[model samples]
Target chain A: MKITAPISTPAEVEPLVRAGARELYCGVVPPDWIQRFNTSGVNRRVFGNLNGYADLERVVEKAHALDADVFLVLNAQQYGEQHLDALTEIGARFRSIGGNAAIVADISLIASLAANVPDLAIHVSSVATCRNVESARFFAGLGASRIILPRDVTVAEISAITTELPELEIEAFVLNDGCVFEEGTCHTVHLPMNKGGPICIDNYQFEYQSAGGGQPHERALRRLEQNDLDYKRWLWYRFGNGFSVAPNGYPWGPCGTCAMPAMHAAGVHSVKIAGREGASERKIKSVELVAQVLRRIEAGESEEKVREFAVGLRGAPGHCASGYMCYYPEVRSRAVVGEVEAKVEVPA
Target chain B: MTIPQSTPTLPAPPGPIELGFALVDERELAAFARHDRLTRDDYLDQLGDARDCVSLPENAEPTHFFLGSEFCEHLLPSVESIDRAVALCERWGLTFGLVTPIACDGLFEPLRAALARLPAGSEVTINDWGVARLVQREFPDLRPVAGRLLGKMLKDPRLPSATWARMYPNGLRAGPFREILDGLGIGRLELDFPPFGAADMYAGIDFPVGVRAPYGYIAKGRICKLGSLSLDTPEKFSPGHKCRRECLGFSEVGARPGTHELHTSQRGNTMYYRHAAGMATAVAEAVANGWVSRIVLSGA
Candidate 1:
């Protein structure tokens, strides 16, 4: 079982690289980051205004230097033709950088990328809503090399898929937060405005637009009636069936712990930790600790001894405990998703 | 009585051309009764008109006289229901088929299981992949009609733009319905349209006016009534309501009193007549032109 983690900063990434981290994944940079960081002002005309490529390139180069893999998340679900075109450009750059990063869930882009660039390995994003082995086989036939298994399946379902499709690599999300509504089943991403429900981050651009529209207090009420609002109305949500929102917030990312380790044990090509937006430090530590414990497991250490080692790595003071991945579930909680309480110490 | 020598031909190709009508409920069937639109007599009557044929359901038994030698689709709720349907069709000497929402699980399986009981030459239609996969695996004779909603295949972006010609010659393009139907391969392949909603935008006809049938009525967020269009029920079929039910998969909240609207945005507040008109035209054309052979009425 190969274990991988997400590391944002040079500080966090260096240790994990040496620790033999197998892979790393991260999100696109915020639009304002180029200006905010006193860099050349960013504009969409040159690079379509998406400036996150440099950061991704840097991470890929560094990780590659350490002989580790880097996965770029072009995982935004809602996009149009233009957005897909931009992705095609970005994907080309990703391939050019000697980056082996496979995109996460984002079907439209997958369709586009598959058509535009067939050589790029297609990792069926978790959100594509593949549920059964039949569906997984369909994706595999369609040239998907691996599938980020949905978070809601029983271990049996996972096992069955793995057994049924030996040629296909199965990746699972381990560290879970609250809620198991599963990725493909939840339409929270496509949920209509309920006037009463919390603002739907179902669409990140919509969330970004709403967030940037004004102050938080004002945006809250306006967002409830998002359909009525304009200006940022350019963004629209697609609510097709077979779409689900996981217990995690609107956009479901990976579980950082249990899933990655299990992926390793299951001989999943790579086990990935989910967080990338922030918590670079926690991301590094979590990956390192998880990898350490997995090494011991691979070494035939007693499950109990491995459990003790995990406790120290993932228990309180674990980087993930605070507000990095999910707000709920303490770092040391016994909940399956809270931390690998048995084998790995979850960092506070 | 002078027995007609030939069915009234719609003026076309030599072979018996297939003809079908959409139905959502029993009221629509009974409404056809009111107009003397179709009956057992019409069964023989239509024989001279067309050779190939299939008739959609009308909240009624498959043995109904209007459906003759051609296939009949019944919306069976369960495998048991499918068994009953198969038995009835055999007794009546009619071709049998099943129409079910993909969302319904139990309905498809039993129908597939009951396929063995069906006489040597019976047929089945499935809208969901599970049933289609199962039926195809179990019974090679199973004829699957890709449900309109389920057949909306995502354009495989990996395929070269040039390869689409080979992949989906009649694929529905990504624009309005005309493009969608044509670009998505749906137009090329035979499929059923959702009953009583929008139809192919390119169709240039309208449903026969003054046809009355029981319609599901929602008022003030609740189903206050259910009856025909002419019944003057308390609730009316708001275009907005219809749009929500058909496109958005939910009921629209707080639509303006006695008003209906459609817009590009699923939940947009701004009302656009163009969008509404487009949907209306598509619905009318599908019915008038036979692009849609069946209509599965809901809320009836």
Candidate 2:
């Protein structure tokens, strides 16, 4: 699997490419666009984009020099009619800057780009939420050359989609910013980080109530309920503990140096490392660490060795006990349940 | 007398537009069908049928039928299911719309097959652009409604305290986004009313809108918690073997004092907000402003 790293600045280009990234993707929020629509143009980055277009052009040019391709992200959920002209211009600039493709979320924008900027490859952002094969085929047919699968799907689902739609390239997240909710459909807005960002992960006012109710309702609960909760027992099992208990798997942490073998076997075209707004050190480390693991996997190292390496690199061993921080929760779950030393093949 | 001249009596505000409820399984549909009004008791039972949406309510005929899944692409009903829903809705003179989720690949052929069976002017809510393109191309007669997912409404659940009040009162939509929706051949758009207020945010967007009930869905997962929630060991409730349609049973979980709420419950392998709510007047006012045309009365 090829490593698809995030690039925000020209400085990140060389080190990331040298680290392991064969492909890089970046977002460009030009000042004019920002001044106009007041966002990175519907991007996932509500804090604002990491780089400007001129900087993006420099990043792309440098990545190209290193034989790595750069994609321009314009993957906001909506790009209004007024933004379309500016959007078309952005696409033109990216292509002119030698950006490999443009990752888009809106269908209208996808249609617009495909029609107006035929030369620029159009990739459907995971924000489009293309979960199934038909969805993949629909976008591939509609002109999106690639589908970046959402973080919620398992390796098996990814394999199924890639298997069915082999013509379109499939990319899946392998590192950074793991989501509790499926990204595209999640409507909860994040407050500015200083205000309390990474919102929804640890927000307050939410509560779950007992399912018990009226006589007939009570009767049905006794008869049909299998996973009923104990409201009286306040031992953390009440209305909805899915978030509080599991905390939605992991935070915007790492998922590097693991799941390589399964990802390769699953036939994923690319594995993305998500952190365009990351610190330079964090960004470089993520790319380098994934690259090291890839090298080991390429050398046919055991899954145990690769995992051990990753755990140490992620600093999970003696220091951390939170398995929720696991990169591949399936593998982690299997490791605990099956009592194996974490070298087994992940479920596909 | 001139000022009081009957104030041009505005057409009685269209009688709240016949709010339609969405069900996850046949049991809820049956309850809706059997009862004149779903009791609080009936609603509690309906919550248990988490992983599966109701097959057409053979008895209870909603004004507009949303006959499909919204979150899980895998849970999409068979083409046969769509065919049956379309036929039944047609017989009832009810408008049948396939409530599509944000999915692309696995649903194409099934949707197409179902569309072939649908009469002209049938609606397929487009949550994914790929679905939109397919509906535009192969299934020309089937109308596409830009789904709420496409609208990208900024939803922030409000707290009781005034500390966070400043974070909200935000607004969405403008001339350009509305034009884009129109460009997509979307005469209608599905909307989810936010916590604080939405009557004004959605004011100028002129497309006929279908507003989902008081509760807006915040976050959901592919592996539904209700689908595999184990009573014995909660930790074991990972996305294991999908439940045998036992999600009908609902449970309540909450934090003490000041806890930020994110209620989730599974409905046939997909999850919706378990405690989503909004005021009736907000929706009524939306209808008054022509911002709403249909009401998707969802699970409370």
Candidate 3:
């Protein structure tokens, strides 16, 4: 499987590629985009954006010299109609830099990049939430070359999509950036979190209130002062359903390298190591580790041996510890979804 | 009795727009009735406190109805429930919309076929792109509305309090995003009414948008509360294990640990948030200025 790693500046491309990155992805926020659209820009990440076209151009050149592909990210989940003009300019600059693809989440942007920049391959970001075969097909129909599956899907689901849509490249998570909730559909507002507030980590201290019968004093509904606030909220926290708080703090960036064998069998094209905002050393270590596992697995190592070795790389993603950080969490824990009942015929 | 040839259409009167409600199943509908069953004035006063109340006005003649789960197929309604929803909506002359969760390999065909059999022009809110494609390819007659789940707007109620300001889409040019959705035949955008950010700003966006009200939907999980509550072990409360569907019995609610405000509630697999003081006005302003075209109220 191709290992796609994040690069920060032009300097990161060579080392990452030599460190065993087959594909490189990066983003840029020009002066205009900053002045006009003051948010995080099209990159979704507040940090890790390339300073300008020159930096991006340098990264593409270095990566191309190593015969590696570079992808520019426009994967922000939301986009404004006013920014389309800027989006076009960004798309043009990315293509001019010899970037191989555009990783995108917004449907309009995917359509935009595909049509306006015809040659650039379209890779749907995990935020697009292609959790099902039909969703993958939807993106494929829109001319997407590859789709990065969400962090929450099962290996079996990945297997199904790869087998069903062989023409399209399917990528899944291998190392880092695990979300407590499914990424594509989550709306927890990460960037400007309150003091310890990004709900994913369960940091925000919450007050429980009764939602039934329109309780006049929701807060006064006898909180009972339970020691385990998490447990109490599980039973009584009724709204649409339940909250997804990252366990053990923000280390939700759990690795999934152990699933390499399954991903290979499933025909997943790439294994992603997240953290565009993370350190280059960390990125390189992740690439080297996953590459070691992939090389061994490819070189006729037993699946058992590889899984054991994968764990040796990091204690995370080992066996199903039922930890909140693990992606494809079912790989270790009894998945918290799929509640469909067994259909059995009862003899009358 | 004169049987009407066509179902009565629910157009917004010259006053406020007609509001609708979303329920996961009959149990939620019943839950809603228990609250609405109280004195109208009393219920209105306590609307924000109701377990399933989505900030809907009591005078709301819910002309449109979304009846199903939008995050997990495990939470998806049974066939019997679908039929019941159709009947209830038809009886009340409400536009029936089936809420679909994430697209699963096994559930797509069956869900598509089931939805196709509904009344022509029925609305189907889609969270997965594959399902969006399914509606375009197989059920063109059904209106495919991209609900808030699919919008993925990052909004947190605690944000404006702790930080300077969160970024929101202010406007857009006639860029590729609009043309692409247009090509796919998707004309509407459903948005979450975030706590502090834009509900949103799809300015120059040439499509009608809808908002999930008072309790704007925040995050969704593969973990489910229905089955979770049954187990004494929180870790054991996971997906795919045996479930009595316990979410039907009770829901969990809480406020931020140190503060009584920024409250969150869990119903099934989705989390809903009640906005802090005065933030509702900002969300309302977004809706008023056409950032959001309608308010979508649903049970988790």
On TM-score, the candidate that comes out on top is 3
Please provide, for model 2 over A259-333, each residue's C-alpha lDDT reduced to its tens digit, 9 standing for 90 to 100: 676777778888888877767766777777678778887788877777666555633342112223434455553
Model 2 Cα lDDT, one tens digit per residue, B150-233 = 776445453333233323222234444455556557778787765555455566657767777645565565545455444333
In TM-score terms, candidate 2 sits at 0.73
List the candidates' TM-scores in order. 0.49, 0.73, 0.80
Better candidate by DockQ, 1 or 2: 2
Best by lDDT: 3
Tens digits of per-residue lDDT, candidate 3, B151-177, equal: 655555556452333464422334555
Chain A TM-scores for all candidates read 0.62, 0.80, 0.81
Question: Which window of ten consecutive residues has the lowest lDDT sum in model 3 chain A?
Answer: A237-246
All predictions: root-mean-square deviation over Cα? 15.3, 8.5, 8.8
The segments of candidate 1 whose C-alpha lies over 4 angstroms from its true place after superposition are: A4-21, A26-50, A74-89, A104-116, A176-182, A185-265, A285-289, A302-348, B1-78, B88-140, B145-294, B298-300
DockQ of prediction 1: 0.04
> How many collisions between residues are there in candidate 1?
58
**Model-by-model DockQ, in order:** 0.04, 0.27, 0.35
lDDT of 1 at A329: 17
